[model samples]
Target chain A: MKSSVRNQFEGTIKAIVRGEAVSEIDVETAAGIMSSIITTRSMEEMGLKVGDKVTAAVKATAVFVEKA
Target chain B: MKSSVRNQFEGTIKAIVRGEAVSEIDVETAAGIMSSIITTRSMEEMGLKVGDKVTAAVKATAVFVEKA
Candidate 1:
């Protein structure tokens, strides 16, 4: 919500899985479960844990729009 | 919203600019204007035009969550 990223979703942490260098976090937002990978160090520094409410931010450049 | 992208927004086409290979599109969504660059070929194939209603989708992997 505070990031420069315009697209933000408020969600609860559903799961957390640790990898070699990065951690996979699954957030259960109203739309769906949004998954992302971040550095384990950042995850620890942020003190993020399962069930914690978080805001997932996606840069506008990373978003693709389409029509059907 | 119809694609595999979990993060999607329904919005009206705000602006579209064509480039040599990719095109920049701006969609005015409820939150904000989502901007993206896509292949001009795909843009033409989709017949996307300004003022059309479209959906913006973001890959989960491209999303990042943080707390403040």
Candidate 2:
């Protein structure tokens, strides 16, 4: 009864939004939900940006439970 | 010549290995690789097991290609 989001996020890469197949990762967390919008195809072979200190290892069933 | 394995696997969960933090997932495929080993954190939540056909989406960055 307690799970909003928090599988893993070691943070930094601020933003990146390029899509053909899928790529829209924005991990910049510190406390909780600083920001996390992930959907990736490795982001052009890990050429990520903004700060680059990654660790976004999500797997909580691919995390999709939208209602809001 | 191009790549060893494809990026996605829309197949059945062939096996599972539970760990303290990460869970090892093995998905069965048709060709190119009958079984592909993956790591996920969604096993408990998803309650995945053998024969459960599910898509395994892995960010290519997390795939650490080790040398043997």
Candidate 3:
């Protein structure tokens, strides 16, 4: 899914779903767009907060980023 | 932009683009799919490494994840 449009946004962590040690960040961007839920086990490692500045860099490609 | 096909994959960080403090992770998933470039300044915060296992949770929505 390669799109010339590099979708990027910055917002606050409207919500956080704590799964095990990993956490899902729900950032609210401009308009009514709910950015994808980013999964990370270490929020402190990423210095992420409920109202911290962050950017989601989406690449234009089709690749599954999961575990076995 | 909601996609029932929640595209998720697991791979290694083939490349890393250092922009200031942020780093772009290029994870190589199954087939020839180059997963999106995830940007993060504190990789240790996310416990991400060059050969560390990671998952990209892509939400089917259109909300820019950038900075202002």
CAPRI-style quality class for the chain A–B interface of candidate 2: incorrect
| Per-candidate iRMSD | 2.8, 11.1, 10.8
lDDT of 3 by residue, A1-68 (tens): 44464434444667666566545666654423234444454455566667766654455433234443
Runs off by more than 4 Å, candidate 2? A1-68, B1-6, B32-41, B62-68
TM-score of only chain B in every candidate structure? 0.85, 0.57, 0.57
Ten residues in a row with the worst lDDT in model 1 chain B? B1-10
lDDT tens readout by residue for model 1, A1-68: 24566567788999999877988888887656767788888889899999999987777678787785
Error of 2 at B61 (Å): 3.0
CA deviation > 4 Å runs, candidate 1? A1-3, A66-68, B1-35, B49-55
lDDT tens per residue, model 2, A1-68: 22212466577867777667666666777854344343344455556677877766454546678796
- Angstrom error of the Cα, residue B25, model 3: value is 22
How does the DockQ of candidate 2 come out? Answer: 0.02
User: How high is the TM-score of chain A in each model?
Assistant: 0.86, 0.29, 0.58
TM-score of each: 0.67, 0.41, 0.39
Greater-lDDT candidate between 1 and 3 = 1
